[model samples]
Target: MQFQILRDEEGTKADFLDLLENFKPALKEIRTATNQESINEFIVKQVPYTLSAGELESIWK
Candidate 1:
């Protein structure tokens, strides 16, 4: 799925968190189909955030 990051800073955090929450299933599906390394690479390529280790772990769970 194609995703876009909002340009405004005002709602960035909430927007990102919402996307993270909503995209959990898709993320899990990707993980199931690919290795963690590949999924991480794909996330970095597809999403806007520079997700930290903790954040990545939280979502994956």
Candidate 2:
């Protein structure tokens, strides 16, 4: 996954460090749940999402 960080010039490092600290717990939770069967189950339980045939065709083209 990719992320873009937008911030003011002032105190960027402190802001980034704080963001990293806050994300640690979420990362740990994801790490603990890192298994293929669990991931497949999660995807199955999620509401199915789709695009129109026109949209898919546009992407393929």
Residue-wise C-alpha lDDT for candidate 1, range 1-61, written one tens digit per residue: 3354454443454576576787788777767535667766766676556777776677787
Q: State every prediction's TM-score relative to the real structure.
A: 0.53, 0.31
> In candidate 2, where is summed lDDT lowest over 10 consecutive residues?
1-10
lDDT of each: 0.64, 0.38
Clashing pairs in 2: none
Highest lDDT scorer: 1
- Candidate 1 lDDT score at position 51: 73
Instruction: Name the regions of candidate 2 deviating beyond 4 angstroms.
Output: 1-5, 8-11, 32-61
Residue by residue across 1-61, what tens digits does model 2's lDDT show? Answer: 1113422334343343444455555544654334534633442343133334443223212
Model 1 misplaced stretches (Cα beyond 4 Å): 5-14, 46-48
